[model samples]
Target: MRYIYDEQGVTFNYFLLTFIAIFLIPTTYFSLFSTDKDAKLRKPSCNCEACLRKENYLKNRKLSSTDRISKKLAIFVAVGWICFAYLVYKVTTVKIEIDVWDPYEVLGISEGTPLPQIKKHFKELSRKWHPDKAPEDKKAEYESKFIDFTKAYKVLTDEDIRKNYEEWGHPDGKQAYSLGIALPTWLIEAKNSPFVLGVYALAFGIGLPFFVGRWWYSSNAYTKDGIRTHTMDLYFKELRNNSTIKQLLDLLSASVEYKELVEQRPSDTTLLPQIISSVKEELDKRFSEKYQPSKRYIAPYCQKASALFHAHLLRINFSDEDLLKDKYFIAERSIHLINGILDIAIAHRWLQTSLRCMELSQLLVQAMWFQDNSLVQLPYINQDIIKTMKLKKKNIRNIIQLREMNDEERKNVFKALSPTEYESLMRIASIYPLLKIDQAYFKVAGDAIITPGSIVTLIIKLRI
Candidate 1:
């Protein structure tokens, strides 16, 4: 058996392999870069008690459940890059025996030379090395050289042979052509064939289905909002149009996220009694017995989660390292549960519940309790400062009203804050969104007034 290399086919394979190399570079870079970048925690904007505690907790917290998975994915991406590099080297370096029969190269002259130049070149070559003129010692080499030159010159000058060469790139018309594959030849050699096939079988047959099945299972387990199906079911069962804020907090405490935490560290059970006692003391001081979370038949993990959540809302910092770590984890995961609850609320068109859910989200972000004065969000402004201001009945509870105060009144109210503190307060206030309504009205298209069941468009023009 003989193998012929197709020059055109081999060149095309080179071009394709080059293109694949270019495509892999950015993909490999971004996958590796993002995995590392996203793992870093950003600095908190405020150094308030809550932010500081949260930061400390996070610093001390255990690695997330997804860390191992991320590392595994990064490893796979790296391995793919290594394989691509190896394939590129193999393909580019492989000794390709392309059998291109170029007439111009055979005659040692450029293509498209004039007919006269072609004749002169052949005549010159024949004078020196034609078979008839060869010395006895070099007769065989001379014959081979003269034959190649005569054949190339005939293909360029003779009308019939030139026509054949133009049509088929060879003097003999329509010669056999070999097909080339882009992959390196050694990949399919008998010695390595079984290993290569086994790799294919493992990747496509076993690995593919394993990954796809894992993805399918995960998709079924969670809602579109990233909350588990059973968790969402629990939310649907417990939530109502008139659910109180305390009840909502309790509902959040009962999420499956806490169960996962307990499962990760069984010793968290030891901290449970201490956390429950601290939360109970804070609640007794702040609210009547009616506002407290009920102890009736809740899971012990749920009870611990509820205690941690209440501790966060009450702005109580823990001295215990393990308890604070648990608090941080609970607070971090609560946002997802809150958003999941908000999704259910909006789906049911429960306006009040939806608003409460949004408020809870804001509470988590600002690290303030529902009953705390909004002024406390400002730098250097605590309960003591708020008391001195005696701002009751002024309707200046929010930042907007505080911004609207007369210059004299504003100075008087903020006298207790340092200049730096006041500047920080003003900076934060300036960035807060305030929409001023210029005009608003309802209109029905093709009608003078909005009628029952008509599609009414409410147009409100505002300045930001």
Candidate 2:
């Protein structure tokens, strides 16, 4: 007989046994009429004809219906068992719980928590269950508990740790632990002892290589061509060896003492000569070594230093309107230099090259505005040129307004102007005319034009 629960061996065996018993009973009962003595012994006799007839009728009837029902019940039980097993597997294998205490939930702490409170909490907890205070009998248990408590408390209280926890969850701690991330081994040894050093070294010996291997393989560097390229490997090696780029970045940082000094008194001309000379010397040194300037490469750090020197020089000359004109011209030239450097950086495919260039560009733009020369004008300028220049300074709304205007509206704004008014506005728009010497020249030409009512010819010329 075909077993419906064949996939489930135990259930199939049970159904097979039940079917055998049903068939065997009917065979044994009919065996009483058998001529063979062994068959006759296995059967039970019925004297009445009605009993014999009933028995004979049942024996003749087909058992296929009962077998089919049994098969269906076996299949149903097997399916139920399978579903139960799957549910158990899912519950065990895919379970994930986020049980770490959230600082915000427990203590109402958030980004705005005061540093003093954090420090105070750390100190109070550290003192209360310090390992040394535990009784001899419970020292080991207490110390373990205390350690876990302190770790959890420290992570929750610290701003950085709390932020990381919020982002990644408690499992992040286990990952960090497995990765052997912690204070530097040397620092830990100095703070604690050689035992700590030994532990760290052992952990690092196993973890560092694994971590580094995973990173190297997982990153783009793992490609066969990337790995085989000697120049690429050497570039990375040099980057790893040199600290000059970091030092140069540190010097240019907003928090640096030099940066503070320059900001506090921007017009301090005394420092300009020294700064310029130092930067030039560094540039010469780097160039002589055949080191190309790049955002990633250490050699280009001198360029940043040079840019800073020029920025400082611009600052010193910022206040004098005449000097401001000269400074603006210099600033525009500096922008070109910066663009050239960015091209070189891009050629090298320097890491963070675009970001560095953007940062420097922003700094230069900010320095340009420091002198209040935003409205300055220059000699021999055209009004159309001034209008174009104004487009550069316009905010999003102004830009949208300009964009939305029909050609006729744009033309009417600039057409039919007298030569002197056009020239004066042009000069006013130029950076040089804001100089003290040129200031008087602008006043003379200010009212030299009057619109003669929408000159169509002039509008066509301007629009075209």
Candidate 3:
């Protein structure tokens, strides 16, 4: 409680009445009610702590036209306050008033109060209102008042926040300097947004670990020995980790060179298995050599290995260009592609070749796992075709007649045979164990150099 004039006032009797009347007042009333732009501009709508304190000062000083309320409301509110103040003054000789929101006013202390004095006053007020000391009927009421006092004490005693309240009427004063409610100036002033920091954190913290883990998981891989290995691009003289297998798979997947080869399979179902198996067998034989592996070949080795792969594809009766240049085939049929490639690598017998083959094998296994195809898709024979051919075995032998046909005649014969018989019989010749194991056929194969446009015979030599 505070009084405009009192010698020994001691209670909030006058303060409560004064507090009610003060809110009814308005700052605009100081214009005597002129709201023109100039008047409004002259009297800004300030709610800063400075302005509120000034108003409180005026309210305590004396009654005057300084009230902020309109004339009519002021008349009613002022008369009502006067009556209450006078009644309490006569009955109790006590006059005290304080603004609830103003901590300085609530604590009955000036903004410039020293810390020691502030603490002393706070303790006195706290002890007076302590619930244990409060009257039974008024315990709850005193408890509420005690909370208000404690909050005020907390606000004023903190030097930094006290300064904030003195200047801005709020504990958090920096908000006054904000850009707007939507985005604070501090947010823009910062070097990076939280979102950008989050992305970097995700990449560095989680993404890096994931990539390394993937590399580690795929490190050890399948090799010609039918075992998994941790062989890196270089031999490790010390204990360390490597993950080349997954890395190679990623590169191969993105490669443009082997796109077609990865996807295309011979459309002739019966011939598909024969060509694939022949190629696989030959690669197996080349890789089965008993020799110590040397350090991988460099550029020169690459050229030789590449030429070998080309010839190797041809040996299995496939066009290298047709098979290795498609994209869908690479992405989808990588298993077959890797299988063939790895076999060639094993045949090379270089340390580099072995390592490269193991990497391809790892990739093939992973791709199969990814596509959920655990079992290899291989060519299957039809019983009907075998039975039909077996029934005509004698007739087939007679048809062949063992003639050394010229190129045109051989072409004509090939053209005459049904696609089924051509693929089936040719497959049997290539793979069937009971057929003649060792025979030789000689042909110039491509354009021959005799006299220009001269025809040549296709010669067959039997070594039985």
Candidate 4:
């Protein structure tokens, strides 16, 4: 009986060990082989059929209270493990940290802030938080703040960096910070260093005069194809402005008269005719007063205001021969005015690049206009004028030498030319020559020369 009891105890121990192993082996297999499905099972809450079936099975199970509690606890453990695994994966796989230094946030400004306001705010803040002003005891804390402030200020002030900051936020700002910050420093050093600055200065000093001299050589009002188009555009802009002004004046006058009529009583209807006459007189006076040239000589302004008027008129094929002949003197005076403006523009080293080019080109055009008018009015000049005025070999050689001289030297050479030489040189220099119009053959007073091949050549050469 004692031996039987010992064997039974051994068998019971073996049975318990086998049951534990069986439970653990299936769990391990599911965890490894059916990970996705096992993950679904381990979730705390799910709407899937598997989860619903498992939930129903657990609910309907006929078990002792202790057994039910154990099963529920096991389910809770599995769900907890799944959540822990997911949390670990997400923490490991995804970047959870971000850079703290944001230039835009430091500035306390954003896109589309007016430039004037930005400068004002920057100046205000810079004065308050500058490290130099901070007390020695607080210097370390303030110094970090100052560094951040300075960096923000630098980025905001710059156009390119500000644009990048506006586009991609902090990531792009970092790239811009790396590239843009370094460039300005490098540029400053390059500009300040005697060797580098001197080389550039020398090149520019030499090259600028050379370029302008070439431009002068090639200069003519109609020669530059783009200039003619631009000039025409400017004229149209002025015309539109003038038309707007005229319309506004008319509307104001009309409105005033209408208000007066509305205010007057019916008993004064007999006096309406007299009132109307008076109003007409007042309107005329007002118009004249508004249009008056003040102590300020405004004719110069008007001339400039309508600078490209002639160009536009020409473009539209307007027959303004009478106006051209009568108003030619006004145009001639404008040429001198434009030349003076050009002289001022050339002296201004800091003028905008595009405006500088425009002023210079306008000066050249004005000069050409004077030359063209003079030739057109000449009795003997004809289509052959270009060939006739072409410089003799000796003259060409002299002009070449003059080309190599400085501006002052070239001016002296220009002054030294004889009247006939000046006229001849100008004619040859003209991009557009007066074409021969045979009034007798064509029976038309004015006509453009239209020989097919010559037309093509002229168009190509003159860019007409």
Using TM-score as the measure, the top candidate is 1
Give candidate 4's whole-model lDDT: 0.42
lDDT of 4 at 203: 80
Q: Compared with the true structure, what per-residue lDDT tens digits does model 2 show for residues 1-464? A: 22122222333334444555565545444432436442222221322332343344334332454457547755655555565555445445653443555544433346556767766765676677678988899889768756665655656666777666766765144343232232333434456777777778878987888898888765753334222233234333332222343322322321112222223234435443454564455434422322233354333223434444354423332234333333344444444444543444566666465456655565565442122232211222233444554565532222234435565654454454545654443433332212123222212223455445532222111210
Tell me how candidate 2 scores on lDDT: 0.44
- Each model's TM-score? 0.70, 0.19, 0.19, 0.20
Best model number under lDDT:
1
Candidate 4 wrongly placed segments (more than 4 Å):
1-97, 160-464
Ranking by TM-score: 1, 4, 2, 3
Query: What does candidate 3's lDDT look like per residue over 1-464, in tens digits?
Result: 22132323432334555565566444325434655442222231233333444355344433443234446665775676577667566547534354337887878888889989999999999889988898999999999988878878878777877788777776666442322132223333457678667888999999999999887765544344432333222222211233244333433333223332233345434433444455456445544422211133223222222323322322233444343233223333444445544544445444564565465555343232222211111012122332344454522232223133344543443554455544543443334233343645434546555455555655755443
Q: How high is the CA lDDT of each candidate model?
A: 0.76, 0.44, 0.46, 0.42
Candidate 1: misplaced stretches above 4 Å? Answer: 1-20, 27-96, 100-171, 188-193, 261-267, 286-291, 320-322, 390-396, 407-416, 443-446, 455-462
Score candidate 3 by TM-score against the native: 0.19
The regions of model 2 sitting more than 4 angstroms off are: 1-98, 101-115, 156-160, 170-464
Candidate 1 backbone collisions, by pair = none
Q: Give the lDDT of residue 426 in candidate 3.
A: 46
Give one clash count per candidate, in the order shown: 0, 5, 18, 0
